[model samples]
Target chain A: NAGVIQTPRHKVTGKGQEATLWCEPISGHSAVFWYRQTIVQGLEFLTYFRNQAPIDDSGMPKERFSAQMPNQSHSTLKIQSTQPQDSAVYLCASSIGLGEDTQYFGPGTRLLVL
Target chain B: QQQVRQSPQSLTVWEGETAILNCSYENSAFDYFPWYQQFPGEGPALLIAIRSVSDKKEDGRFTIFFNKREKKLSLHITDSQPGDSATYFCAANQGGSAKLIFGEGTKLTVSS
Candidate 1:
């Protein structure tokens, strides 16, 4: 298996610009999760989707962040008008399902908002 | 409040030594515990995990000793090697919650 594939491992964006991160999860997986990782805050859950349906997004910032899983194979996290504080490594993971199952993660996309 | 917490912000141990990383949770509902290892420039990967049904779970050289009464768990890495050095994270999930609550990672360095 190819595991999870993420695009543009590194991204640089000007403050106030929009940034979109992509994730292609492992085949046959049904659950996709998006998280943000930083040295100061560690890993913070952003949103999740199961079988192309959004399951929960309580962790997402109220204003600028949004996520979508149009299909079972991939998901995307988009940050609009990104700020310096939005800079972090955005990670995507997938699992067979919830409850006691292991979630496999992708390498993550490092976003630098300058 | 942080539901899950990990101790010893960072730890350093010599090769061939045993490095123990501790974690605690405040939620009684959390039944699944997982330890993830992250290398620099890479996302975290599942290292080991345990369920509330068991007090101890061992896989290879990494073992998880969980205390249900105390709501604590520890990951012991035996025969630590330089390659084992990375940031280790403790995460918890409840029976229904799909997302994991992660603790501030504990950075480990194994010196050869």
Candidate 2:
């Protein structure tokens, strides 16, 4: 199934520049999730979408982070005016459905803000 | 406050030995628990999972022993091999929520 696919396996940007990460979910899956992994925070749930509609984004940073699932095939997470603290491994996952469903994750994009 | 927590941030065990990774949660609403294994540069993959209704769930060399009363669970990897070395994360989900609360993760290293 090729599982989930993430583009730009590695990304580097200036401290103030913006970064956009992409995720292509598994075909026929209805739920997509975004998570950020750091040495200090571990895996933090950033947001999620179900059937192309955003379900919850409570974990997203209030100002700089935003996510969108424009269609069933893909989702994007954008970080505006990125800071050094935003540098981390961003992971994307997809599931057949929500709640108790098994989530398959992509390799993730490693963002480095220098 | 972290809702889910894992112990022994890192562990090392000899090949053919059994490695036990422990986890505990503070939320009583969490009913579904899943363990994910991640290599150095890859995303996490589902290893084993258990529901609150069962006390034990096994899959090949991996098993989950859950204690609902204590709000704790442990993953037991028997006959461990070098390939089993990776970070293990314990995650929990509430009844109807899709969001998973992940623990700090335990890094396991099985030496040959």
Q: For model 1, what is the alpha-carbon lDDT of residue A99?
A: 72
Question: Each model's TM-score?
Answer: 0.98, 0.99
Candidate 1 accuracy as TM-score: 0.98
Report, to 2 decimal places, the DockQ of model 1.
Answer: 0.93
Span of ten consecutive residues with least summed lDDT in model 2 chain A: A64-73
* Model 1 ranges off by over 4 Å: none
lDDT of 2 by residue, A1-114 (tens): 899999889999999999999999999999999999999999999999999999999999999899999999999999999999999999999999999999999999999999
Off by over 4 Å in 2: none
What tens digits encode model 1's per-residue C-alpha lDDT throughout B1-112? 8899999899999999999999999999999999999999888999999999999999999999999999999999999999999999999999989999999989999999
Worst 10 residues of 1 chain B by lDDT: B38-47
